[model samples]
Target: MHRTAPRLARILACAAVPVMLVASGCSSDSDGKPKAEKSQKSEKTDKAGSSGGAALATPESEKKPAVAPVKFTKLPEACRSLKPKTIEKLVPSTKAKAGTPGRSTDLLTRGSCSWNGLDDNGVKGSQYRWLDVSFLRFESDAALGTSGKQRAQEAYTKEVAKNRATTGAKNVKAAPSAGVGEEATALSYQLRKTGEDFSYVTIVTRTDNILITLTYNGTGYAGAKPPAVADLLKDAVPAVKETVTSVTAANK
Candidate 1:
């Protein structure tokens, strides 16, 4: 009977040990959650942290904005047809003057004449002569014309006012004048200087364009026939008109 009791006691002890372990695993803590559940929650938080770390490693190249292409166009006729010799007379040419002839092969008709020049300061100058009369189909857009005129007038007035303030010229005056009867606007002013070298400025606005002409000569030549320098500009006007016409037609 003693040997049987010893064996039975050993088996009962083994069963109790397994039961205690199972109860401990299933029991709730002070927070009323099982230990196994807490371990699973910790594992889920670690996974989320790992995912956040991976996201932070993204490269900067993916966050950049796309760039747009550059747009360039030909110069307007009023600005383009300026003669080099006339310009040289107006603004004395320096040793560093640079000039190159160019053409607009893009024109529908091939009678276009063009040139490019540079000043001592490396500033570029250009001229274009278009003889094709068919190039006038591209009249200035109505909206663009109005806006351009307004902006040009404002700038001219401001520039004149600033010049007067800086130079303190006596009897400084400016008013709008008719510009060749082309629905154009002009601002003219007479400037007084010592030794009778009178200076006059004419700012002409035509079809969304502006031309600034400055004349300086002694009284002997002021009222006489227009200075030979002035004729250079007059001669270029037809060429400019033709070139502008060609360019406009090509664009259309």
Candidate 2:
């Protein structure tokens, strides 16, 4: 009986050893605080990705308001009558040539006028005339130089500056005009008023002394209520520049 009692005591001690080890492991952290851990990189990556996605989701409609179309009408006889004098004032040096009256695609009855004379820089010049009474629009100058291409550029620059000053243009920038063919170059200054009107003056020159100055001006139409004239000028300037550039290229 004594031998059996000793063996049973050994067996009980062996079973209690495992329970003690498990209890010690579970209760090791007596302060009840969670283990400190390093920050996860995946969380930062996810945040950065979400921010970038948000930045790219902006819509185009929010960037700019739509512009309204322009309402147009025929120029009254009084308006048409002033055209000759106005053209003379606008281009004083050139001699007026006879013009043909006609209808244009933009819904204006236009009278064409032309002239030949020396440019501001003393270059020989010739110009085509276009006067639209309804919009009070005129484009009547085409010029070339006896001085040289560089002189032509200088003359045109001066002319553009003078026109801008005369018209009280605001928010102006130099831009490309339409090319005539492949070689003729063109450029212009676009002008706009914040809420009033749009207009532009373009200067196109070739390697030859040919310099062409074109001025465009207009108010807004019905469904397309004219934006601030200034904003329209801003938009029109660049467009006219592109057209002049193309024309230059074509002329080449």
Superposed Cα deviation of residue 45, candidate 2 (Å): 99
lDDT of each: 0.39, 0.40
Candidate 1 — what's its lDDT? 0.39
Report the lDDT tens digits of candidate 1 across residue range 85-200: 54354434323223222354543222222222222322332221111111111222343333333543454455445545535244444454444312322222333455433333
Candidate 1 lDDT trough over 10 residues, lowest sum: 128-137
- Kindly give the stretch of ten consecutive residues in candidate 2 with the minimal lDDT sum: 128-137
Q: How high a TM-score does candidate 2 get? A: 0.28
Cα deviation of 170, candidate 2, in Å: 1.9
Tens digits of per-residue lDDT for model 2, 1-252: 999999999999999999998876575445543233113445677889999999988786565543322222232222233334444543334444332234455423222223333223223222222222111222222232123434434655665455545555565555444443113222233344656344443333222333333343433322233224344334433433343343334334
Per-residue lDDT, model 2, residue 202, is 38
Among these predicted structures, which one has the highest TM-score?
1
Q: What's the TM-score of every candidate structure?
A: 0.30, 0.28
Pairs in steric clash, model 1: 130-243, 135-245
The CA root-mean-square deviation of candidate 1, after full C-alpha superposition on the true structure, stands at 13.1
For model 2, the local distance difference test gives 0.40
